[model samples]
Target: MRLRGRKGIREDLEQQQDLVVLNPEAYKGKWRERFNNDYPIHVEFGMGKGRFISQMSVKNQQVNYIGFDMYDELVRRAAEKTRIAWNEAELGDPTTIQLALANIENIEDIFAPGEIERVYLNFSDPWPKKKHGRRRLTHPRFLEKYCRLLNTQGQIHFKTDSETLFEFSINSFADYGLQMTNISLNLHRDGINEEHVMTEYESKFMGKGMRIHRCEVLVGQDALQEYQKSRLDKY
Candidate 1:
């Protein structure tokens, strides 16, 4: 886990947001004002380096996107890509996409009640140890956080190459009473689905002949309560 010299990369990230801190706490319930749009806000938790979100934002100008990643170095790299997009006139506008350094577990602090429209959990870290199961992005605890942030009928689109995490997520979704839709075991076999955005990790993993697992779970008030109850039982 020894990462080489990347301090300059982190410094680059700091430079990108020199004028403002993209901490979620500062913007918390004011997402609408931040983007100056009433459109639904979709977020990608653990945006590796922002490749996926940047490309998606450029392709779809109507949807507002917020990418939250914990690593400062990673956020900086992603922010650099975003800066490039903003500079290019032919790339359309991505003023809707905001990058933030924040923990995914703190969704309440990052988003107001029912403010998020969709969540993309792409190639998230799979805490393999059984004791670390709760830390998994698809765990009930994390799912509850996402459920609370999402608007009624909001959806979570998840893509991962890990079968263990995918199974864990599917069970969590069904157990929590969320409607699971469009479950796919192999993404590339489906003829390059437009809805499926590829992350940096996804590109590398899929290149090695891996099967990408994906699913969409719809969130509602009723589902939120059920998710909360299930998470409570775990404690």
Candidate 2:
């Protein structure tokens, strides 16, 4: 999707800088302190319009949620959605949701080791070319970064509409030695409809009769080490 420049996008983002971490580099290892709570930090990478993260934060006040996207315009829109959601939900503290403009390729620079409890990859780019396999969010390189950022029991919850990407991600996770569970080829058809926050892409795709694939993988130190060794062996 080509992103057209939005008017006043810069100014809009500046106005919500308090709610969005414009300088994520400064918070790097101290994200928990920024939230002013030890509540488990959950992040949604590629949080396009922010519907899922905003709703998730509103519903689960105990968890601190951060939504990351590469575009300022997208982050600004997400911040607005979060603010509106907080007001409608009548939450006392709206600090539960934090938006950030950062590229996923450098996620390590934004988060510290063991700082995040969970990570969500919702409708991420497939990077469908074989030559672009390494660029996929579920690729071994990206998974390595996620592993370092996640705590002992941290898990990745991934949802996608692309079957090819889903299958590739499953193999990637297995190759990295991550333990997978709650695997569903067609999420909505699996009789697990409750508590599922629908994202814009998810709603559109599912409404068009496209099945959404979902999976959860637990990160472990052993898996990380094995993945690292495999990478070394490729040299």
Q: Kindly report which residue stretches of model 1 are placed more than 4 angstroms away from their true locations once superposed.
A: 1-5, 8-11, 18-21, 85-89, 221-235
Runs of candidate 2 with Cα error greater than 4 angstroms are: 190-192, 220-235
- Per-residue CA lDDT of candidate 2, range 1-235, in tens? 5688689888778777669888898898898789888898999999998999999999998999999999987898788888889989888547877999888888888888988889999999999999999888999999999998998758899999999999999999999888887799999985447788999999899779899999988785554455567779999
In model 2, how large is the Cα lDDT of residue 80?
A: 81
Best by lDDT: 2
**Model 2 quality (TM-score):** 0.91
TM-score, every prediction: 0.85, 0.91
The models' CA-based lDDT, in order, is: 0.79, 0.88
Residue lDDT tens for model 1, 19-137:
21456797878987888888778888888778888878876889888888877766777877776766674754457788888877777876787888899999888888999999898
* Residue 101, candidate 2: alpha-carbon lDDT: 88
